[model samples]
Target: MKFRKATSENVQAIVEMIADDPLGSKRENYTIPLPKTYYDAFERIDADPNQELIVVENDIGQVIAVFQMTFIPYLTYQGGIRAQIEGVRVHKDHRGLGIGKTIFHWAIQRAKERNAHVLQLTTDKKRPDAIRFYESLGFNASHEGMKMHF
Candidate 1:
């Protein structure tokens, strides 16, 4: 498998992977919806230098997973950056094969290289398996994260 930064060419595959999930039906925030023009995703990712979209490809160059990471810089943390991981998804057939873990480790290392103090992400309470996966990777559930949809 090979991993690389995502480009507009991979948007369709990434969108399909994310929307295929069950939770995405109700939460319109996790992943970008399907049938979108590639330019949309391209513009968004291009606008933010601190944000990155990445993809994982199989040996034949087929995209099988996608995720985005956002780095938030703060002065309170002694000029540290915090990496917020979101929109992580692996193709249904590609799950349980360590692709997710590999991408996550890559993201963590990227964060560390950028002087990030924390790498954080949030999963819906209903995704117990996801929570366990994050915990297994050394992430802790310590804060009460609340969001209000506008």
Candidate 2:
């Protein structure tokens, strides 16, 4: 498998894998010739030095997993940088092949390379399986995450 920053060609596959999940199915419009908004967002992320949209490809060069990482400069923690992981997804066919763990290992190493003091992510409480998988990767439920939909 290969991991790399995503390109325009990867946006569709990434959205498809994201929408395959329960919550993303409600929020993402995954379609042939996806909405321009998706491409626009990708462009913005691509231009930002602190943002990384990553994809994992199989041996034959098919995108099978994806995640977005953002590095934020914080005034707290001694003016440190925090890495946030989001939108992680693995194609349903490749779920049990340890791709998730491998992808996370890559993310963690990337965070360390960026000199981030901490790496954090929030998963919807409804996704118990996701929470368990994250815990297996050494994440702890140390804080209660709350959000208000706009």
Q: Pick the candidate with the highest lDDT.
A: 2
Stretches of candidate 1 off by over 4 Å are: 27-38
lDDT by residue for model 2 (22-91), tens: 7889998998989999999999999999999999999999999999999999899999999999999999
Report, for every candidate in turn, its global Cα lDDT versus the true structure.
Answer: 0.84, 0.94
User: Whole-model lDDT for model 1 versus the true structure?
Assistant: 0.84
Model 1 lDDT per residue over 1-150, tens place = 787888877777876777677877555343445435456766789688999888889999999988888999988788889999999999999899998889889989989988898999989898999999999999999999999979
Worst 10 residues of 1 by lDDT: 28-37
Instruction: Give candidate 1's TM-score.
Output: 0.89
How does residue 79 of candidate 2 score in lDDT?
Answer: 94
Model 1 clash pairs are none
Alpha-carbon TM-score of each model against the true structure: 0.89, 0.97
